[model samples]
Target chain A: MNTLDARGYSCPEPVIMTKKALEKGLPLTVMVDGVTPLNNITRFAQNKGYKVESRAVGEDYELTISK
Target chain B: MKNKQTLLIAATGLVVGALAVLLTLNGNPANMGFCIACFLRDTAGALGLHKAAVVQYARPEIIGLVLGAFIMSVAGKEFAAKGGSSPMTRFVLGFFVMVGALMFLGCPLRMVLRIAGGDLNAVVGLIGFVCGILGGIFFLKNGFTLKRTYTLSRLEGTWMPILSLGVLALLLLAPSLLAFSESGPGSMHAPVMMAQAAGLIVGALAYKTRLCMVGGIRDAVLFGDFYLLYGFVAIIIAALIGNLAIGSFNLGFDGQPVAFNDGLWNFLGMALTGLGSALLGGCPLRQLILAGSGNSDSAVTVMGMIVGSAFCHNFGLASSADGPTSAGKIAVIIGFAVVIVIGLANMRKEKV
Candidate 1:
């Protein structure tokens, strides 16, 4: 399992970063703000067959992916 | 695999569109609802690019769509900076697309919104668009070719994003340059930052997903690809939900905002745009994204849209809420003929 942080990033940035990390072909964790980035990242993850879970942590969202 | 991709693309478009509609409900405007064409038209006016006083404003959706595309491209490692195709031809096609869009006073996206809003006129315009697209498909099948492009330096394709950033700077630092309507359709707007932010994000996402209405239809019709088309459907559904949420659902054609009562011209105008987009290989939104990715051809098309707006307004070829100008009707006819001639003429004598 691998973890990537994107908490302070804006929409698409977090998603894009998460995607970049996923290119390593390992289960990963992504953090993002707002509903949009979450949707984008989660969809990307789900499509790739990575198991995913999300929870609101204070001001932002934390999403963890596993395969 | 294709179904999943289709669902993702369409769902993303729907979510983005719904968010855009939410912006409108919070004081944006009606049936304007969510349109890249109308918004770009307003942005042009805000820059005093045209004197159509009733329809100018700095549209956030346009800004958001591009920036959104940029962000995704950069993040996903897919933002390959590249450009150079038949720039002048692309520009002319873009201009004609805008001309046609103004005739209808809406692009493909708006056509969808119109249908969602229950405007029967849009149904006619959509049929025209399909006919035009079919025509373009014919050209495509017959080896009508725009030359293959060579990838350009990254900085070359970064011009649109830089320009967008400049617009944002102007919006925030020099507000006076943006024309605001004292009354009428131009006066209505969501907040400047909000509009820009939304546009930027949507643009970036669209760039990454390659969510193009023109490509969606073309691919579906020509190649049997449905990924992009799904995004097109998503936008309508999201817009409907957003309209419902904001109590802006009108459900009929009697009185749509920023749209005219002319039906035939609307059909012709959208038909022109549809054909132009098909020939050019992307919608206006796709053009912007391509420009962001360093495609000079797309940049040229965008330039055409800017110039076409000027021509549409100056020559009285643009429609108003009341209806299409007589000049606009003539322009639509001439515009269509001109595009047909150019498209056929541009075909290479030898297959590339």
Candidate 2:
């Protein structure tokens, strides 16, 4: 499982990073610092047919994407 | 609870729209109150960045907007110094967005106001604007991004707000240092204190509500989210009623104040504005609000807009009531090409 830290980033950046990382294969965990990114990444990953499990990590969110 | 929040946001829009009308009635340009692009152009002219004498005036509203957002964000504990994601790119995009806006003689907010005043040409511009947003959404769906931003020291984020204060001081204490338009659109303005108060109220509300015309349409198209769109709709309704009551609602393409009847240029201009704004992650007004809240990237974007405003007026690329200049048309085309190239270059490479 590869972890991608997308904290401290704004919208579309986190989603784009997630898309780029997904090209290599799934079971990836992405860390984001805001709700906008969390919802956006979840939507993007789900649209790509990936299962996304998101959980709160204190003030941030951890989203795990797997096929 | 959500309904209350929605009602509050709608009320905010109504207040903004009504204030725009009031500002216009008090001497701001007709159907031209609260235009970020036009006001910025005037600010650039006042600073002597451009020799467009008719448009020179250091608008107090802009200064007030920055300070208002700064104060609001600080009070809300939402002010954090952060930036460093493709500053130059945002600068260029901001420049092009100004070009497109000046070509159309307004920003999206003004476009809405124009429609509320029954300017049919703005309807044409609106069509183009939506088309441009759709084009941007295509790129966004394919993973367009400006990359990551990093948090910076608090001092770094205070520069824009400080600059705003400095400008305000100059406007109030040293009026001789800035140019004032003797005639034309620049000369027409509400009283200084009134304009400043209007900007402060609108800016604080916008900051609280996250009101953005570009975000409104983009979210609606991309996510089926109408939360942002509702604010704009409220603005339209509120402004429409105000314009009608004030007898300012003139329905025609000709003889509209501070506007031209060139439909093609109007469409292309706003199209460029919409696409550039969509790619930049915010519109001109949003950029200002963000800069107020300590985003240096948005500050840089605002600087780009000022320079672009100067460039438009200096080179005669900005339109006038007479119509769009040939040079203005060419510049808009170049702006599109440059923005497209930037958008293409920044996207993540697809797997081979």
Candidate 3:
């Protein structure tokens, strides 16, 4: 599993970057802050039907997706 | 000229726009509300031109609007192929307009409808739009002009309708490539045929009436004309009723579906849209109508809108379900500067 630290990115950057990461065909973990990013990234992964697990960690979030 | 004719057009536009929204609720897209700007943005997303990932679809209403308007133009013999008025500038304006609308999370039509639906942030947006359009009017009064267009061969203009047809064909044949959202904003859509029919009806009426919010406001302010602006009011009344009937009126900005409540950005974003639409000579819907009539300038504007959506999504300038991004704010600032420069540099001085 590859982990993406998207803590600093906003809006579509995290979504776009995650899309780029997915092009490499790997299970992934994306760390984000706030519910909007979580919703965007979660929707992105779920739209592609990637298995995802999300949990809150401090002020940030950890989202794990499996290929 | 005639009250009956005006009333007919306004009523038809209202019904068609409302039906478009209701259809969106059934299966098309949520809160779409007959916006060429937003539909073109979504079309850009469906093509993977930009990976917003949340809002992507080859909206049938967009296709329907162009095709519908084309049919009306042909039937009425009002179709004339013309263009070449600072095409590149118009394209950029269209693009920036989309970026601004996305930042506010809706187009001009949707902006008004959102307000009618009780989203108070739209009040800020509407104010911004009016102010922006008034700014464009100032440029106009000072002799800001895009180059005039001459007639083009009819065959050349037919290509836009053909392109729309091709899109419709792709939508029906390879639906998967359209890339609808399964669980987000894109997941919400009006029914396809219903949406298309609504668009077709609205396009036809708008083609006849020259229905455009920016044009309406600009004309009212600049020329003391209120005919076109009345249609805008009609749409608000109709959409408000529809929202009430559907139980979607929320009366606040905080939790409105498909909208964000960042007051400053909301105001500025729509102001940018209003200004751009004014400079381009029409709102997004009017641009589509112009394109259908073979105005390549409008076509270029439409293309620019699609590209702008791609740029906004890819560059983090678009607002999301959460709110507007910082990049979106910066882009709006830059976009405003760009519009100001375009207006100033392109102003034509009267020859002695």
Candidate 1: tens digits of C-alpha lDDT, residues A1-67:
6678765332223544576677776667776644445765776677667788899886467888888
Candidate 3 share of real interface contacts: 0.00
What docking class should model 2 receive? acceptable
Sort order, DockQ high to low: 2, 1, 3
Q: Count the backbone clashes (under 3 Å) in each candidate.
A: 26, 0, 9
Q: Candidate 1: which stretches are off by over 4 Å?
A: A1-67, B1-3, B348-352
Cα lDDT listed for each candidate: 0.74, 0.88, 0.78
TM-score of 3: 0.81
lDDT of 3 by residue, B137-231 (tens): 78876667675565568876777788888889888998877666566666567777877888788888887777788877876676454657788
Per-residue lDDT value at B286 in model 3: 84
Off by over 4 Å in 3: A1-67, B28-30
Fraction of the reference Cα-Cα interface contacts (below 8 Å) that each candidate reproduces? 0.00, 0.31, 0.00
Candidate 1 lands at a TM-score of 0.81
Chain A vs. true chain A, TM-score per model, equals 0.78, 0.95, 0.89
Better of 2 and 3 by DockQ: 2
- Could you give candidate 1's per-residue lDDT for residues B1-352 as a string of tens digits? 4466566687678867776676666567666655767777777888888887887777766766666777776776556554455778888898899999988978887787777666778888888898888888777665465555555688877787788778778777888868877777678877766666667767766775777778777766764545577888888888777677767777666687677667788778889999998888878878877676556677778888988987888789888778888898888788889888877886757432
Stretches > 4 Å off in candidate 2: A1-5, A12-30, A34-67, B350-352
Query: Model 2, A1-67: lDDT tens per residue?
Result: 7879998776655766777788776689999975557876876676667889999997678999998
> TM-score per candidate, in order?
0.81, 0.90, 0.81
Q: Whole-model lDDT, candidate 1?
A: 0.74
Best by lDDT: 2
